[model samples]
Target: MMTTPARIRVAIQIPPSRADYAAIRRAAAQADALGADAIFNWDHFFPLGKDTSGKHFECWTMLGAWAESTSHAAIGALVSCVAYRNPDLLADMARTVDHVSDGRLILGLGAGFREWEAKEYGFEFGSPAQRVQQLGEALHRIERRMTLLNPGPVRKLPILVAADGAKALRLVARYADIWQTFAEDDAFSEKSRLLDSYCDQLQRDPATIERAVFVDGDPWTVGTRLRERGAGMFTLMTRGPDFNLDGLRRWLAWRDEHNAQASRS
Candidate 1:
């Protein structure tokens, strides 16, 4: 099982789309006040939910603002698109944001998808397997570029890779500091176990790569069971421009209660 960072943390995904700047900023403030350990926004060109034409801000730009906006919490994208920009440039951008946040950046990255976004934005959306392969390539490029970038990241920006396929798990062992898997409750144990097995065969220290998951359902019953299986952190995606973090308050309370229990134990 994972250890260190004794108390578990909650990551709140506040994708700022469908509303105005004031609305998005308000939600961000709410997440910060609710004591979330981390705040996140999805990297997408458009809205991912019901509000297709909703007002959405770009990911990196919003994160630059989020860095200065909140204190004492890590911030990241759910997963940035490796296919959209040059990996080296992406690393540079992350380093810049890291400096802006005073070393509070967690670079969650993944292969690019969403063909419509790509086509509309003039990016090539390749096949699924190809995209995953491209993601692995991007990881390699970023790591190398990070060292060469004149002014290094304000902090050693933790690389969070997202994928559950066998190839992706192996890549996680080879490169990732954290593997972020998203799904429902029952599947958490199975995916984590599968990742553990992959870690075993690769002779990579399982502990090196943290296992983090996010759920859209109730945290009480679903999130608790996932935690029992050694899930280290949870994410609740609250979509915005009209973002309300009422759910975040409940989850943070749950996190605080658990942290206390762990301490006493």
Candidate 2:
């Protein structure tokens, strides 16, 4: 397991919907230049908002573009559905992107929740428990395939598992380098404690897995409280056509201040 990262990191998830590819590309590049620690796009075939028919793009292909467009920030899908693609194929694609980004890649995975996408795409949208089981199997294959790839990853590519339930968190404890959660406030703290227990059961240091939270609204307000509850990575989400990055700037400033204070302490 990797040591705890030094500073609080801020990331942006630029939704790949309702905007042109150019606009999305520009926003990603700008966010990277402005010092976002990571940049992300979600994996979904359709629009998540009210408008069912809206512009959208695939995940990994856009990540490949992000690899060329953004030089600094790590790029990835916020959480790719393991069921959508074959595990070995996905691992190979990730390895390719890791090389494209010169190792600035974080492979985020989830059991997958969107049944509509699965049905439309002709995938087996199994029950929640079944999907979790599938995810565990795929993760094992992904890890094994990564080792077998000819060029391999540029580094031991970090695995960020977005999990909220006990079953999923168990997978996280065994496989993840970072654990991303959507639970907040008291719920967030409770889940953190639960994850700690899982790590203990596995004889893994809880500190080895960095905590990430996906948040909206005032970054400082959300981030400040979560920071105390073991969140070291904060992800702010923005949707296009106007991918407003004003919030990202504020979060970056707060991260800088927090890191500086930690260093001084």
Candidate 3:
């Protein structure tokens, strides 16, 4: 396992589905106020899960609002679909949001999946490999555009790549500051080890990339085990209608305890 001394960070992803934008906004603000290191929303045109036809909002626009709404926590999409917008335009949007948040934006990106949504939106739902190749190209364009922009980003905006496959892991090794995946326990450990191998081939320090995973169980239980296996950032998913933050509070407590221990060590 890749070793690092970084303190653990907690993020809360507020799914903007099945609820009004006002409720989503309140949840984002609340998560930030509750000491979440980052707040995120998923990028999708329609609602996910059982209530697929329910109300939902766009990702970047909501991020702009979140930029203004919260003061401390960083904010962005959990993973913005790369196929949804032109890379250069997306770069400009990220730069603008970074300014709005005073440099608290983490651009989480992924190759687009969900063929049904792609067909509805008139995007070509290419094969999985093709889409990942496209994502690699988009990342290059985004980095280029960031440099060309006149004022540029207020800070070195971190890029978070959400991927798990071999090619995707290669891109993560090359471009990501934070690498996030949803695998649990052994699956997560295996993928993380593969990521380290990819980083080794690229001559990049594996520990330079923060490893993040979705917390599916009790934070103290699942999260502690993942932390032991080299993951440092844990993201809790909360869905709207109510966007309950009880879980986030518990996870934040776990984060505090973990960070305190790291500092003491």
**lDDT (tens digit, per residue) of candidate 3 on 28-57:** 888999999999999998988765799988
lDDT of 1 by residue, 75-138 (tens): 9998899988899999999999999999999999988668888889898888888888898899
TM-score of 1: 0.93
TM-score of 3: 0.98
TM-score of each model, paired residue for residue: 0.93, 0.97, 0.98
Which sequence of candidate numbers ranks them by TM-score, best first?
A: 3, 2, 1
> Model 1 clash pairs?
19-241
Which 10-residue window of candidate 1 scores lowest in summed lDDT?
A: 1-10
- What is candidate 2's lDDT per residue for 1-265, written digit by digit as tens? 2233467899999988899999999999999999999999998999797786999999889999999989999999989999999999999999999999999999999999989888999998999899999999999999999999999999999999999999999999999998999899899888888988999999999998999998777766877778878888999988889999999999999999889988998
For each of the candidates, the C-alpha root-mean-square deviation to the true structure, in angstroms, is 2.0, 2.0, 1.0
TM-score leader: 3
Worst 10 residues of 2 by lDDT: 1-10
Distance (Å) between predicted and true CA of 136, model 1?
0.5
TM-score, candidate 2, is 0.97
